[model samples]
Target: MPPSQELRRKAVNFKKGFKLKLEPEEIRKLEAVVEKATDQFTVEVAEKLRGLRVALNDVANSQIGADQAMQAIRSLSLEIKGMGGMFKYPLLTAFAKSLNDFTKDMGVPTPIQLDIIAAQIDALYVVMGNRIQGSGSKIEMQLLGALEEAARKYRHH
Candidate 1:
């Protein structure tokens, strides 16, 4: 099966099993834990972005390393975008898709799409970084990141 279809299937099933624990206290605790996790996830994604920048900083210093970084960025960007779509977070998914195209265009430099994508990432960086860094955007960031991570693990196989 196509990876996308398989991921969607798994996500659907997982969502179905998310019943709260029978005890009220346990359910509340679970919610809190989930919330905390969500925030950390957003920050991690932001850090990953920074890592990409660091990796790409010396594109001229080592072309092979830069190329690998770019490839990883493309893969990670796609993974992020796919999670937004699966979870019905349209805005994030839309931006992620645009970002994915942006990284892909870096290789071919075609169709004038890279510039647009770059601008979008510049804007998103401000938000994603702030949220990831405990600037009050944690919950949203974490939810998005957690969802994406769940959906993308199969890709590593």
Candidate 2:
């Protein structure tokens, strides 16, 4: 048998990151900043919606770059999904998430799929245009339900 060797151990000093707690006043100030940024969010979302429309139109027209257009749609929807709830528009977040999910694996969408996409885009426009924040009204909920159902039913087809 070989001679036994002693083992050496090293201790690691893990440093704690920045403090996560915020004072009440800090929270209020942060909320005020968020509230003031809603107008900027509106402008950004409007621009993104315009890009969505242009991409959708490209897809609808059977352009040679349909794949790129679909990619653009996916990217824009994701951006919208990420920002909507931050501005207190959870409904917008929901709709954008639905759009993002529906188009996640899409390629050369069918007429019915295009129709669904168009409806989703229109719903987004209505939410932003009307400044419908939060979860919105009963009709809006119904619309969301219908869109989600349609997306689920036709996703694989």
Candidate 3:
């Protein structure tokens, strides 16, 4: 057998409790399943992002109770942070993390902070609506940079 095959065989036969390695055919089958799941997830994420965009706008405009808005944003941001990578949208994850950090324990954000939040929400909307995946494209880079600058201006400490 070739060296690679020999190595794979050895790995499979190792006495220790290592996980079983899939044969080449099995690996291909598993990859197809993963691809299908990823595609479905991508489709689902668009709707979720649209909902988040609406919620974020509502939170921004709410004048009665900032706490309720904060709570809603917290939930949405956390969900985006957790799910963005699963759907192959790391830029969404990054934006969500930033928004999450900014909103942590923030009762009512200052006007400047609200501006930063609006920028983040808009960026996320653009990315999700356009179906931009991974780390985002060139235009996304510009958008993220501007949003980050706005965020930095309001970051306490």
Candidate 4:
């Protein structure tokens, strides 16, 4: 089976067995924890962005093997993607996933492809720095659409 299909199947199976109801108090506590974590994440957002920049630099400079660089980019992308929504910046998640998919689909990228990746990363940095919120606002959607276009355009090359 394709990896995507297999992953979907596993996700379905996992969700099927994951039925838990949180009590009101427990829900409140969990929300509070999430809020606190989000706040802390905001404080360190620049550091996280720097880490991503470093990963991209390593890939661009060929300082690391392609496979290792890809892994690092994938790891950072997943981390940002997974946490973005939790912190109320779902656009960041979307952009990060675009970045992750681009890296995965492009294999060892060409210079042009690297430029695309860097563009996405820069866009992400803007979103994180500004704390853009929700799934997307009008301006955010426009920005995301542009990023998506760039990804699509380069993905086929």
Number of the top candidate by lDDT? 2
Give the C-alpha lDDT of model 2.
Answer: 0.93
* Pick by TM-score: 1 or 3, better one: 3
lDDT of 2 by residue, 107-148 (tens): 989989999999999999999999998999999999999999
lDDT comparing candidate 3 with the true structure:
0.74
Which pairs clash in the backbone of model 2?
A: none
Better of 2 and 4 by lDDT: 2
lDDT of 2 at 28: 88
TM-score of each predicted structure versus truth: 0.47, 0.86, 0.70, 0.77
Estimate candidate 4's alpha-carbon lDDT, on a 0 to 1 scale.
0.80
Write one digit per residue (lDDT tens) for candidate 1, span 1-157. Answer: 5456875566655355554445787677766765656655566557666654554443424656666766766776676666543333344555566556546646532223333434445545654544322222555556445434533432222
Residue-level error in angstroms, candidate 3, position 35: 3.1
Error of 4 at 93 (Å): 0.8
Q: Model 3, which residues run further than 4 Å from truth?
A: 1-34
lDDT of each: 0.52, 0.93, 0.74, 0.80
Which is the winner by TM-score between candidate 2 and candidate 3? Answer: 2
Pull out the clashing pairs in model 4: none
